[model samples]
Target: MTTVAFIGLGAMGYRMAAHLPQHFDSVLVWNRNVDKAKQHAAEFNTQAVTLAEAAQADIIFSCLPTSHQVDEIIHQVDIKSGAIWIDCTSGVPDIARTQATYLKSKNVSFLDAPVSGQTIGAENATLTFMVGGDAEVFDKALPAMQALGKLIKHVGGSGAGFAVKAVNNMLLAVHLCAAAEGFTTLKAHGVNLNEALDCINASSGKSGVTENVLSQRIFNRSFPNTFALLLLAKDTGIALDLVRDAKLSAPVIALSQSLIQAASATSDADSDFSAAVKMYESWSKITLE
Candidate 1:
């Protein structure tokens, strides 16, 4: 029986980690917030312990916020050889490679398995995982991965997962901003917002934004915290860095990155990304709802 340890019980991490008890006998939980970790462990009837204690598990899953935080945990913990560490952090590819290589030298296996589909997908256990690591290690982690996500793929070697995630999030920003621009344009021209979405979703202009963000968040007028604007800004910047680092010629990606970066600097920087629609509305002098 493989022992499991889950770190960083944030919004998505908590939902993702909650599924481990369904498959593993002992699923240890750890978070920077001690109270959150203790409560989560109590909810799952698992262990709430220190980083060193959690590091002792046969397999560990981390869904932290940034690469720096991930590196900090790796250095702070007392993980031994043969322990497998799977990081679901949406982070920098270079950092992922640097850490993965370091962990490999310590005989600790690493998988950069960044995820998509946000909190809804995580709560439903249908998130998409873009995993990057050795093929054999992927096979070893498959059962646990199955417990957390539905669309799981072994993308490539170390850092490939973050690369895929960067691209995925980059496109998401493009689509979302496209939707925002479209809504603003329609409203400026006096088109009813709901009707426009009705037509767009049924037509070729449909996207996740039209099908999900606009309908669920913008139309509802609440735009609750599903995923934060600061995070979106960071993810888009990661994609932009990927393009520049690889010498790719993607003008639209760079433009989208700038749009989100600017929006993230606004007063609602901590709001849901769907709140971008509000920003668009304010700037365009048009209201979607």
Candidate 2:
């Protein structure tokens, strides 16, 4: 059986790592905060250990928050040859490629396999993974990913996962802002929100925002959802870097990035990204609820 090390135990990581021991014979974890790592280790039947200990595992999966963090952790840890490093960070494509290249020189393999489906998806083992790496490496990584996600695809080589994740998040920013603006517009015209959402969901004017976010977080104004607005805003910047690097034109994406950035700056950084609705509410002076 394959031995594994799962790092970064944030909201998504905690749940994702908890599911790993069931698949692998020995799954180890190490958090900056030792107690949390121990707690998770105990519950998941894994070991709580140091970074070097985690690095010795055959497979290392990271759910870190940023590309820089991924880079930093990989460099800082005393990882060895023959280990497979799969980064699940929503991050910069170029950086992922660079990491893969660096690891390859040492006889270690790397894959950027950023995930989707959010916290609920992680907990339910129904997440989707966009993987970027060699075909052979991907084949080796597939079973471990399947333990955490339902849909898994090897999109392309090296940084493909990062490319897809950035683009996906860029669109999510656009949709979230549109959802916020749509809700405010509907409220302004005295249209019933519930009815509008139902119609929109049944028609073309719907997205993850309308189908899932609007009712659960924005309309209720609860925003207990665990995703970070700051992270979304940061990812938008990374996505734009990709677009601009490719010399593509995207006016709406630019505007949506600005709105999400401003909201991340003004609203609680740690709040669920659905708090993006607060940006439109502030501008229109009408709350969704």
Candidate 3:
């Protein structure tokens, strides 16, 4: 019977950890908030343990907020020498690779497995995972990851997952901004919002933003907190760093990053990423809702 340890009990982490008990014989959970960890452990019929105890599991999964959090957890915990560490955080690629190297010195295998799809997707087990690490280690962890996502792909080695996640999120941000601008423009020209979405969905202009997020969430005025604007802005910064390091010219992505940064500065930081529409509305002096 394999034992797995899960760290972080936030939105995505909480849902992801719920599936572990179903797959593994024993599952240990740890969180900074002891009450939350205890609640989840009771709900899932799992064990609530300290970080050090959880670190002794064969596999240790971390779904933290940032690379700095991951570093702090690593330093505080006493993980078994040969335990596998899987990071689900959308962290910097270079930082992920450096952490992987450091963990290797202790005979611990590290993999970056940043996820896509928001909170609803996490609840539905429909998230897509982009993984980066050793082939053998990935194969071993595949079954565990399958419990949390519908699609999982090995992008490459070490930092590849972060690289792919950054690129994908950069494009998502750009598409969302463009969709918001287009939606606002069409409304200004006296077109119905729903009608404009119908035409766009049938045309080449349609994207994930239009087909999934905008059509479903934004139009409904639900604005449920799925992926926060601040997180998206942080991801954009990571993408910008990747682009700069590669000396690549990505004007649209750069622009989108700036727009998201501005959005994050507003109260929308705690709202959904779809709230980028709020930034456009503020600029055009028009309300989509």
Cα lDDT tens digits, model 3, 24-103, are: 88999999999999999889887999988999998988998888899888877777988899999998889888988988
How would the candidate models be sorted by lDDT, starting from the highest?
2, 1, 3
TM-scores for every predicted model: 0.97, 0.98, 0.97
lDDT by residue for model 2 over 1-289, one digit each (tens)?
Answer: 6889988898888999989888888999988889999999878898998998999999999988888988988888778679899999998889989999988887889999999999999999999999999999999888899999999999999989988998898899999888877778888999999998999999988898889988998888799858899999989999888889989998998888998899999997577898888877877899997
Worst lDDT run of 10 residues, candidate 1, spans 267-276
Colliding pairs, model 1: none
lDDT of 3 at 252: 91
Model 1 lDDT, residue 178, Cα:
89
What range of 10 consecutive residues in model 3 has the weakest lDDT sum?
Answer: 267-276
Q: Between prediction 1 and prediction 3, which has the larger TM-score?
A: 1
User: Model 3: how far is 244 from its true place, Å?
Assistant: 0.4
lDDT of each: 0.89, 0.89, 0.88
Q: After superposition, how far is residue 13 of candidate 2 from its true place, in Å?
A: 0.8
Candidate 3 residues lying further than 4 Å off, grouped into runs, are none
